[model samples]
Every structure is written in C-alpha cells, then in structure tokens.
Target: MISFGKILFFPILFLLSLIYRILFFLDRSFKKKRTLPSSVTISVGNFSVGGTGKTPFTLHLSKLLHSNFPSIPILILSRGYGSSGTGTRRVSENSSASEVGDEPLLLKRNLPFAEVYVGSNRYNSYLQFRSESRIPNDQKVFTLLDDGFQHHALNRDLDLVLLDCTKLSKAEFVLPLGLLRESYSSISRANFLIASKFSEEWEDLLSKWVRKYKPSQTLKFKFSPEKLIPLSPGASEVSLKDLSGRSIFGFAGLGNPDSFYSSLKDQNPSQLKTKSYPDHYSYTKEDLTHISEKSSDQDYIICTEKDGVKITSLIEMDQNFSKWFYLRLETVLENESELVNSVRSFL
Candidate 1:
C-alpha cells in the first residue's frame, strides 16, 4: 500500500515531469539544427543514471579502433562531472582526476595514444579540436563521446546505448522514482544497443526484451570485463600475481561499486576487505584516515583506476599513505566482428 506522503508527492512529481518533458522536446528540436565537426563521432552512453558499464565499453571500442587504424587520431570528449576545470582542457599524462574528471583521466591512463578533452559543452570542445593544428585532418579523426546519449546538441554518426540487465526489471518509473534517464521510447534514438555485463541468463532475457520492445534493426552487442590491471603509484607496470597472498583493503567511488568489488574479490587474495562510497564522491582526509584506521593491519589499499586518479594527489601530499593501488578493468566484446562491422557501416 502506498503511503499518504508518496501518493501526494507522486502527483506533484508527475505534473513537474510533464512540464519537463515538454521543455525537453522543445530543447531537442532547437538543438538538432547545430552543425557538428567533420570528424566521425561515436557516442557510448546508457539510458539509466549509472551502472551500465560505459567506461569499459568506451575503452574496448577505443582499443579496437586504434588496433585497426594505428595512425588514426582518436579523441575522447567528456563533460568531466567531478573535475575542477570550468572550461575545456586537453587531458594529458599529468592531468589528474581533479583536473579532468575521473573517467577521462582513467581513459588517458589506459589509452595514452588517444587525445582526451574535458568540457561542459562537447560541441564546443570538438570545434576547438578542429581548429587546433596538433590534431591533423590527414589522420582519420574519430571522436568518442562519453556519456552523450541524451546530449542531442551534437550530431553523432553512431549512438551506442548500454543497458544494465539488473536495472531493466526496475525501470517502470522515470527519474528520481526509478533510474531511467528518459522513457522507453528513447531507444529509438540509438543505432546500436549493448546489453552490458551480459551473462548466459541475462543475455536470454535481454534478447527477449529487445524482441518485444526495441526495433529489430537496432544491433545488439554483449560486453564484460576481460581482465583487471593493477594501478600503483609511480609504477608503469604491476601484475595481479605480484600482489598475490597480500591482505588488501578495496575501496572505490564509482557508479557501480559492486562490479569493482566483485572483480577484486575474484582476483585478489581470499582475505580482501572491501569498502564503497557514492558515485563521484570526493574523498576527505578523514575518510582516508577511517579507511586506514579500519585496515591498519592490511598490507595495501586497492581501488579502481578512476578512484586512484583522484587519490593520487592526496597520496602525493602525504608520504605515509603511498602504499595504495588501483586495479583497471577493460571490456571484452563478445562479438568482435559484428561490433566492428556496425561501426564501419556507420563510417
């Protein structure tokens, strides 16, 4: 039974949402007329707020494209949600999570060859790139837009939408009430649908859902993390085997903390202790102190690559907390040929 508060609150929310939808429709129509850069833009985003595995998928796609066209210049554009910068800036090896956001920093660390840019306005960033001489036109330039499914202002050549299998069951209500960013009908905008974190059971259910709800023409791809790479301070390389038999304290501030925790639990020593925080959470000294106090006996504190980037500056400030490390995860596409073909067809 619905409570009186919920019954009353829902009606107000419904009315506000109706107003929002009308405004969104008008914004989308007006924004559609803006011209995009000449470079091919491929957006990898999700329908829900979080836990759709967008980062790993973006990394996977970047690696695939880089391998196929070695000389081509690929640029990644992101809004840098938790980053410090007010305007657009190019992400480099020296750029920290505070400077360029966690995801962009993670991308730069993983794919050193690709140029990463962070800005509130992605279209403006693309335009800036087009004017820059550093990024040559002779090199086949492809723009990989991060978290841009709803960013309709910039025209994307290919729109890849990620769906979290777990969230599908709980997608009855719209934002705040439920996780969906838009209505189910928004699937019409995507050129391809990626059922991320797919397992045998989830795959079957996802296929059934797609058959019933999505267009048959929308291509589907399944993806999961291939392996985990360790993220150590001032270290270029560290293997999972190197840290075996050591007691670990795992922590991260990401959309889906469970995935990272699970990955570490599977890979780390059986005696690993785990801790989690809210997405894009900025860590304070007290938080770190609490972690240290809890895991004082532990040998090392492990975290996700994104979280590691944010904590690097903190670690650098104090010498006593330099033992922390991060593990990087990469997406392994289930259907390589189909995924490549879909992208190539768009090109």
Candidate 2:
C-alpha cells in the first residue's frame, strides 16, 4: 500500500509527471509524419538539454560514413538552436552565429566540405536543401540530424542517443526540477546508446541501470581535447604543451560549463580561472567588456569552440584581445571499428 507521507512528498512530482505524459501523448498523436526522398538519415541526440557532445559525434560519424561508403554526400540538419533566422536556410561559410546559430556555423567552419542546413521544421529544412542544391538523383546522400532525439516529426533510419555520464545521478524528474526532456524510460526509443564522460562510479551506475532497462548496446567514450586552434582565421594550430605554464582564463556559454572547464583543466595550465554564461547566450558589448576585464591578468582567455563562434564575430580581434583561443574537442569513441560496423549494419 502507498504511504500518506510518500504521496504528499511526491505531489508536485506527480503533477509534473502527469503534465509530461499529456504532452507526450499529444506529441505522438498530432505529430505530422515527415518524409525525405531516398536519403539515408541518422539522428544524433540526447534526452537532456544540450550538454552532450552531439556536434562532435555527428562530425565523427559523418567522417566514418564517408570513409565506409565513399561517394555518398553528407548533409547536416539542425534546428539552429539560438539563431534568429526563420524558415529553412543553408549555413554558408560567411554566415554569422546569429544568422545560422553557433552549432551550424561551427559545423560549416569545421566541415567546410559538407552542407549544413537549419529549420525548425526538419521536413521543410530538407526540402529547402534539396530544392536549392538540386544534386543529381544518382548521387548517394546521407543526412545527419543534430540534436534530433526528440524532434520526432521527421523520419530517421537510426537514432544514436548520447547519454551524458554526468547526468546519470541527477534526479529524473522532467523539466522544472530535473534536466530530462523525458523520463529515463524514454531511452528505450534509442537505437544505440553512447555513454559519454563517465567516471568509474558513474559507469557502474550506468551499467546497472542499463541492465535493468537495456537498450541494444551502450558504448563508452570520452571527449578528449584534440588541440588548441586559434579562433582567428589563417592562424596555425597549437598543441596543449604549447600553452603550458601560462595563466589561462576560460569562459563558455554552454549547457554544461563545468565540463568545458574540466577539459581545459586537463591541459594543466599554470593558472586557470573560468566564467560561465547561460546556454546559447548571445554576447553583448558589455559582456565582452566584462570578460576582457576579468581576463586582463591572464596570459590567455580560452573558451569552447561554440562560444568562440559567437565571440569572435562580435568582438574585434585587435591587440588588446589577441590572447583568445577555443579548445577543439574530438569524440574519442571506444571500439571505433565495432561502432562503425554496428552503424553500417543499420545503414
């Protein structure tokens, strides 16, 4: 029998659960079925807000897919998270973070060879890309949807859900109290799980949880620091050792700022200080002035690539602020060949 104390304690949680279920039901019931013509589509997504390394995974997966199946054109689709642009738009080389959002802009900058498009409506976005580009019908195309786990309107061949090891222990309530977009049980919808950034304890917790509600496969991986790349154009790349013993001030406008700071910490800087802004935050002149002021004493002001995308455009890169760099993160997926093969089989 249910205890009265338990019932009273969980009243708010129960109400939130009820609301989530209703929204879930409504989503499933009214979501319009979307279509794409003869293109292999894979979605990389997370259940929580935005901290998971979806962009890196998507980039790595695209490279893998191209390596496995040469001659297939890859198109990246995103909702343009914080961009002000409306409707379906292709991100260009010169597009600002405000025009195409940070992720899409970063994607374009990183993978200049691939096409990146953004639309609130995934189906419409694909259509726009298809119509504007007009690639030959004989060409093989594979589309990767970024942050697409919950964007269920569009059809996808496989869904690669990234489970943040950091969030494994957080309270599982939806929204207002917890970070989950849906209940942990919604993980069953995931075709494959990439358990990322876990400690030994977190790994153990994840393993027990997965055994209780196992999906197809749960692969473990870490987000390793690749290199320190200059945010300024035409600048050469530098190794972690290049900046050793330097005073570094780190800042990020990210869903998980601590994770970025920790990555920066791994490099063993002589002095490390950090500032965090809200996720997808657009920087103002005042904010930049404050960051510059705060970082004045440091030898370098470092940030994640996403923050760099937005920051570099707004702030002039004169001598006063030439000490900035963005840390480029790479997806160091475990069992790379096996994971590729697993995804290939699905393809």
Candidate 3:
C-alpha cells in the first residue's frame, strides 16, 4: 500500500536533485576549483551517500600502493566528516573521532606508518602535508583522496568509484528521498568501478547494470568480508568459526547497519538482536548504559569496525561492559592483475 511517507518521497527526491544540480552548477561556475599536479593523487569514492565500503576500500588501496611502491610514502586525504576541526588537521596516533572524525582516526590506527590528514579543501591539505619536513620534498608521493567522487577540484590520477551491489538491485533515486548522492550517470567519471558486497546471485545483475551504465570501464572488483575482531584493545581476534552459535547483540551507527547485522547472522547463525543509530552517531556513556541494559542477556555485543572504534573509546567509562567486537573486511578485486596493470598504465 502507498503510505504518506512514500507519497511525499517523489517530490523530496525532485527537490534534492534540484539542489544537487544547483550545487553542481555553482561548483563548475562560481567555485574556484583547484587541480593539483596529476603525478601523485588517486581518489576512492562512491556515488551513494551511505556506506559502500569506502573506508575499507581506501585502506585496501593504500596497502596496494604501499606494496606496489614501497619507496614512495602514501598520504591519505579525508573530509573529516563529523570532525570538530574547521581547517586541515593531520591525524596523529592520539587523534580522536571528535577531533578528526572516525574514518580518519580508523585510518591512522590501521596504517600508522602512513600519513593521514583531514580537510574539506583538498588543495590546502596537500600543501600542508607537502610542507612537512619529514615528507621529503623531492620524493615522489601518492595521495589517496577518500570520498572524493564529487570533489572535482582535486585532479587525480585514478578515480575509483564504489557501488554497493545490494543497493543497485533495489529502486534507485537521488538523496533526501533515496541513498544516492548523485545520479547513476555520474558513474562515468570513475576510472575504475568496484562493485562491493554482492552475492553470487547479484553478480549477473551487477554485470548488466555496469554494462548499461559504465560500459567503457573494464576494470571491476569485489569487496569481501574477511574476519571479525574484538573491539577492546588486547582482546582476542576471532574468526567466523569462533562466533558460530553465539548469542550476539549487534549494535552499530553505520550508513548500512543491515549489512553488518546480516553478516553477523551469517557468521554466528544464532540469536542476534541489533540496535542501529544514524551514520556517525557519537555514542555517550548514557547511550552505552542503555545498550548494556538492553543487551544484558546476550552472549556478546558485535559491531562494525566503524562503530567499534567509537564504542571502544567509551569503554573507559564502563570498563565492566566489554562484549563489543568488530568485523575486519578486505577488498578482493576480481581481476587483480588487470586492475594493477590499469593503475600502473595510468601512473
């Protein structure tokens, strides 16, 4: 049945698209777009507004770059979404989510060896990082621009767009009414298209969609969920086998909580209750107390790596409550050789 919410969604989508177009026009016309030299920048972004596994993909790409080019230092550029900082801030080991946002903090934690900086303005961030004495001026550098599909100002050597295969199966529309940030046609801007979190059944459907939408792009990849890790520091990392038959109270503040919930069910295959908050929701001590009360009966609390980082920080307040764990996923490209070759050819 058509609900009132559904009835209003069409106009809302129209309005969202209108705003998007206006912004696009302003960006092209009024905004003084900045383009850095093409020698060192690569962008990993998504067309959709929510979680398309961009963080994991960005990490994966960073690892790939590090492995492929060991001599060159890799730098990550992020918008620092939900961060309190106004200008460019270099993410350090001690940086909190509130200071530099969750993803940037996560990146810094995961790849402590690399440099991670957050800034709304890509050009300024680049300049700041470049000016650092440690980062040699003459050495060739590679910068990974996170969530930069629409950040057209910064020139990039590679533009990798992530597509959530599950979302593609459903009805597609632009934001306010839908999850998509931009039109499907925007896929053309991508040098590489990564179809993420798809099952075998969805592969045929995704192939068709890619052919229709981005036929020129040949490099394609898959994102695979690898394993689960406990959120608390020094907690034992467990495989999916370890979680089997466990009662899990899954909680997350993610753009795609269902993905985390479903993945948990698959790994555990037992009684699993979930609580979802908005994407980038900062959980307080009170919030944890409430969740703890609700999940008292469950064997363990589980969350995504994104949520794990945030929630783990709050563990100091309630040391007794420590059931939360996170999933560790890796980007598994279908044609790794081709992807590497294409990127290398471009570089």
For candidate 2, write residues 1-347 as lDDT tens digits: 23465456577766776788789769967988676776777888887887877777777777777787776778999989889999888898789899789989988887866899988877777777777878876555788989888886888887788888877665555663456787767778777888877557687788877987787777776777888878666667778887678889999888877778887787788999988888889988788789889888898888888888887777665645667788987776777677667656644
Please write out the lDDT profile of model 1 over residues 119-168, one tens digit for every residue. Answer: 98888887787677465554457889899888877887888888876555
lDDT of 3 by residue, 169-258 (tens): 687666655667777887777777887776787778888897789644644456555777876666676777877887888888888877
**TM-scores of the models, in the order given:** 0.86, 0.90, 0.91
lDDT leader: 2
TM-score of model number 1: 0.86
- Candidate 1 least-lDDT 10 residues: 223-232
Residue pairs with clashing backbones, model 1 = 231-326
Residue 331 lDDT (model 2): 75
lDDT at 168 for candidate 1?
54
Residue 32 CA displacement from its true place in model 2, Å: 3.2
> Residue 284 in candidate 1 has what lDDT?
74
Q: Rate the local accuracy (lDDT) of all candidates.
A: 0.74, 0.79, 0.77
Q: Evaluate model 2: give its TM-score.
A: 0.90
Model 3: CA > 4 A from native: 1-3, 12-16, 29-31, 134-136, 218-220
Largest TM-score belongs to which candidate?
A: 3
